[model samples]
Target: MIGAFCGSFDPLTLGHVDIIERASRLVDTLYVFVAVNSEKRSMYSLDQRLAWLEAACAGLPNVRCAVQNGLVVDACRKAGARVLFRGIRNGQDCAYEQNMAFMNGYLDPDVETVCLFTKPEYDLYSSSNVRELVKYHQDVAKFVPACVLKTLLEQEEMDENIN
Candidate 1:
């Protein structure tokens, strides 16, 4: 059955990619959902996030990606997904994800939520940290995927030239 990993994906980090790689192997098809959250503004636009994800997931046959707005359960249903996958890097992350999973279950009983543990190297990494590093002119090569790094660098250069 198809499964989906849904998140804001402000910028696709190595951690998110790790989750996608593992989740893809567990299901017939993996849909990467870039869900929009209105309450919190994102560093990058939805279009940019989607582009980065497309580049990061290139050549993955079963991995499909799209921007999802509205209820996550609706995104799962629209994608014909049987599972809503999340990545947990530690106990704190696990607790948060578990609560989300439970709420999603309450919303849609037909879809199951699964959490995959992140690799040790990416355990403490996050897109917010990556953005902070980029803002401080620090190398975030270790935190984000190559595609994201490339785009980030290019955008940074553009901003510099603009200034």
Candidate 2:
């Protein structure tokens, strides 16, 4: 089965990797869709984010990456993916994802959304936290995967040089 994992992936944290790895085990193919919403601004550009994601998921055969600049459900359907993989970190995440899941169901009944709870070790890591650390120019290597960290650090250095 083809699955769609949609998120801002501002910096692609370990939590996102955890979900993708888990979903890859359950599905035949998993497409990591980086959400590029104009209204919900992101710290990194879509090109940068997708590059980070692609590098992070390099070795995973079942996992591929792409960028979608519109509604997630629409993108999922357009991609011919019937399952949506959502990673839940806690109650707060569940509450928010639940609404989105219901709304996605309402919009496309055929596209099923499944929630995968985060691995205990990654429960505290989130994209927002990574973004905060990046904004302050703090070391975020420990929070995200190596590939993501590498890209972020390189980008930061480039930005610093530009400044």
- Number of backbone collisions per candidate: 0, 0
Candidate 2, 1-163: lDDT as tens digits: 8899988988789889889988988889999999976666788888888998898888999888999867888888888899999999899999999999999999999999999999898999988888888889999877998888777778888998999
Candidate 1 C-alpha error for residue 73, in Å: 0.6
lDDT of 1 at 118: 90
Q: Quick one: best lDDT, which candidate?
A: 1
Q: Model 2's lDDT to the true fold?
A: 0.88
In terms of TM-score, the best-performing candidate is: 1
Mark the regions of model 1 whose C-alpha exceeds 4 Å error after superposition.
none
Inter-residue clash pairs, candidate 2: none
Cα lDDT computed for each candidate against the true fold: 0.89, 0.88
lDDT of 1 at 101: 84
| Cα lDDT of model 1 by residue, 27-140, tens digit | 999999898887778989999999989998997899999999799899999889989989988899888988988899999999999888898988988877877888898988
Candidate 2, residue 66: lDDT = 94
How many residue pairs in model 1 have overlapping backbones? 0
